[model samples]
Target: MKWIRKIAGMQSSILGINERNLGFIYPNNARKNYKYADDKYLTKNILHSHQIACPLTYAMIDAIGKIEQAWQATCEWNELVIKPSKGAGGKGIMILKKKNDQWFSQSKPVSEQDIFTHIANIIFGIYSFGDSDVALIEEYIRPHDIFYQIFPEGVPDIRVILLKGVPLMGMLRMPTSRSDGKANLHQGGLGIGIDMKTGRLKEAYDGEKHITCHPDTKHPITGLTLPHWDEIIRMSLKAAMKFPLHYLGVDLVIDQRKGPMVMELNVRPGLGIQLANREGLKDAIYRAKQENLLN
Candidate 1:
């Protein structure tokens, strides 16, 4: 907990998960907004209505019977992402890349039956928080060259915490061989803190150790400025305003061609973001409150 004190500086500013949920998310986020952030299909629709750029939805399957037709419809797409519409923690996400009529999942060839069963399980709610869920197939994002030079295998995304439509803090989550090509911290990815004003990497941590370079790529991670920095900030704020929730965690991905696109929105965003930024949320939280921005 020493790092907690170092980040918070004062005991009063320290916020625990329970406190955060009760004080911020519970009070600020409405129930209706939860559906928009929880369900991928609903999220896409909302973003579409707001004219916010996001990964294009290729297809959606809500029943097991439609799995075959859905798969067939996506045959023309050489690269696609299949995910549970209401998934959490990056679970139930399958990335498929086509090669000469063969489909592969993370370099391992997967049969058509394999893809079918996975989608079936998703519809049955195996990854949808124990409720019936829909499967979303969307265009796969080819990460920008700047990120590819760091870790070329997986898609890296930036998580920005916004309060009352104002950008607060941000972190760049990079995928490693350990995270199995997913930019999820609990899955063994790296969390690199970013300067809120500049969108430049400042500090990085690989879950346990402070790092200046990526553990696997061995590439220096700090001091590099992200392209479309200002747009990313503006996009995040715009996305927040579209939702009823005042507190939000907006995920953005920089595609090689599409530029910055909204990946997802979280009403109850994880606390790992605080660790990633190497700072406490209390200062920003209190500042927003004092400025009447939380209203």
Candidate 2:
């Protein structure tokens, strides 16, 4: 079956932020329920309790005094991902790998002091929207082998926007040299469209123009279908049902071994996905409404 009901011959209606906030976010999701999607640690708690697929959290620090304790607990791992609990837009996220007794981030050596400083900044709300935030130290996720063809390294994430627990639209965000290995469109990465029914990738959009292949690797990326498409959908639906929020933007990554792991959720997912898919959220919502599928 098609992921969305067909609306033939009609033009796709672009969804703007104002409309998104008013139409879907405000009506479907209440302000008090935002924490289900806003806080990374809280989101993971739901995932963990439900036994859903996600990266294992090594440690979390919410106070300056707990910094050393949290770091010491998770520092034994050769690799770790540090991020703000309430961060948005991929901010305050760092990956540290141990190489020959030295910790490194993005292939550059970082001192033990550097790791501690980053975590302190996270707790102080440096990368968060609030004045203070929790720091999450999680096991680093290794991207699926299929992504190596798209980029030499870096994990690309799949963003699935859902309404009323049903999948609406999807996009594959991949990293590039300019994005510093971060797969966010606004950070100079590429947003590749996804075929909802086929799970195959469409063209790549670099926040400006659409292309068919990776700009740096020159590898043909379009038409390659991602594995475990059905499981990915079910995994998303499980998380959505666990939360009180009706509107969600669920971010996930395909781990080389774990298949699909939920990364985080957003009550207010961006509208740039429209450009990535060359389709519109307005159009998808309208179609879902007509089919009585959003119930």
Candidate 3:
């Protein structure tokens, strides 16, 4: 009921799917330049060119013949993340750790051939709607300590929405037991609103209802402080300005050692953020425009 009360006055300002596409996405993001954001390898290249921090690429394999050699270069690393460059919804991603010269995923032993097979599957585009894709062997991020106590299983991230290089709203995504360690809100994870100016936490929306504590860890949700808040916004806007897209959703993760690193960029970001923040994008967009007019 409190959550309901919080959003009571914002009903008229909600941004729905249709309005989002026609008003924000289609007009601002060009189809030809979507590759800069849609392809993981290409996104990293853009981030690298602008000196924006992101996960390090160990290798990129586009052909079946090069899979073995590319993966070999990453052998010295204790942990690695393999994913499809054009994958979506967290599909085509594999994380493995090494022990005794063996790789294990989710604590289950997997053979070297199994790793090769997964990489080959990525190259064949099994995850990108049947289009050929590249395999990205990159750095595995261990989230910072602040996230460890919240939920230890998956890597949580922050989503910042920006338009014309101006940041508007922000949300923190955290994993829940039901989400199977995936921080996607639709997959049963939690999306908590953020006080963009103060970097303070607010109520969390778990798809159905508003909750103040983590369902899995029993940790408090509101008023939680996020570390490196400035860096996250700065990098998000940096990438936004650097890209051709005017409207954007910049995703970022706080690495245990590296601080905030850009994870991905989205030209057509979701609207679930309104429920998380108990606010509407319409109002945010208007406010940003007003501010821009004055300055």
TM-score of each: 0.94, 0.94, 0.94
Score residue 100 of candidate 3 by CA lDDT: 90
Model 3 alpha-carbon miss at residue 202, Å: 0.9
Q: Would you list the clashing residue pairs of candidate 3? A: none
- Output the better candidate (1/3) by lDDT: 3
* All candidates in order of lDDT, best leading: 3, 1, 2
TM-score of 3: 0.94
Pick out the ten consecutive residues of candidate 2 with the lowest summed lDDT.
1-10
Total backbone clashes of model 1?
0
Tens-place lDDT digits, model 2, residues 1-295? 0111222222549776677788889999989989888988999999999999899999889899999887888899998999999998889999888988899899999998898999999999999865799999998898988897789666799989999987999999999999999997778889898988789999988866789989999998898998888888888889899999888989999988778999999898877777778898888888888889965
Candidate 1 is scored at a TM of 0.94
The global C-alpha lDDT for each of the candidates, from Candidate 1 onward, is 0.87, 0.86, 0.88
* lDDT digits (tens) for residues 230-274 of candidate 1: 999999998998888888899999999989999999888766667
Which should have the higher lDDT, number 2 or number 3?
A: 3
**lDDT tens per residue, model 3, 136-224:** 98899999998898888778999999988888899999988898788887778898999998889999999778899999888897999
